[model samples]
Target: MINKDSVESAYCFLHQKYRVYEFSNSETQRDDIEFAIASYVNDMNKELYAHLAKGRKEFLCNHTTFAADMQEAINELELRL
Candidate 1:
């Protein structure tokens, strides 16, 4: 079972990786970070749905509800494009 602390730790790691990538100059670095970010989001979705399947209705990570967390991340990505 993935603990809440582990999930939160990953969230913070991805958050910092993204912030660095957002300002990075190398195209190759940006591409790598993009891939990493996509993978992290996919994993998060799996975790969220697993909780939902077990009848846990609400999930909080990185100081936000799951939906809010996703929205914030999506908004940040969109702003860059």
Candidate 2:
């Protein structure tokens, strides 16, 4: 289940760090950043999300995570968009 508190916490953090992101070229910047560090991001943004939907994150370095961590990341991404 998605933990509101954890998600909120990440949202708060991203808000604090990326306050101007939305006003800035947020989406483009995100794409550029991913482009620069494609290996790190798994290149799973809109550009590749279409083709790489399956194993979209395969390029990302594998790491362990609790469900809460995944939810928190999803929340942050959604909130940013």
Candidate 3:
């Protein structure tokens, strides 16, 4: 079973990562951040993957969905846990 600490940790880690990429001004930094996010997402579980995928798709298309997505995921996860 997924624990609260684990969920929070995952959320925090991804949140920081995306926030950094989101505000990045350098193309090289963005590329590196994207690579890092992709690598982390690739190893995530189904629950986390679903949230990240949704966020990533919307972010790519409109650039303003990942934060909300992550927030929603954490809220849901915390409540469920």
- Name the top TM-score candidate: 3
Candidates' C-alpha lDDT: 0.53, 0.39, 0.58
Residues 1-81, model 3: lDDT tens digits? 455566676677666766786688987886676566556655556565565456454432233454455455555655645
Q: Would you estimate the TM-scores of all the predictions?
A: 0.46, 0.28, 0.55
Q: Candidates 1 and 2: which is better by TM-score?
A: 1
- Candidate 2 or 3, higher lDDT? 3
What TM-score does candidate 2 get on C-alpha atoms? 0.28
lDDT of 2 by residue, 20-71 (tens): 4334566676444334333423423443333222443533222332223334
What are the C-alpha RMSDs, in order, of all predicted structures? 10.1, 11.4, 4.5
Candidate numbers, best lDDT first, in rank order: 3, 1, 2
Candidate 1: residue pairs that collide:
none
TM-score of candidate 1 relative to the true fold: 0.46
Please estimate how well model 2 matches the true structure, expressed as its whole-model Cα lDDT: 0.39
Model 1 over residues 1-81: C-alpha lDDT tens digits? 655664565556556875776578988886676666556645664653354334443322332343354445444434433
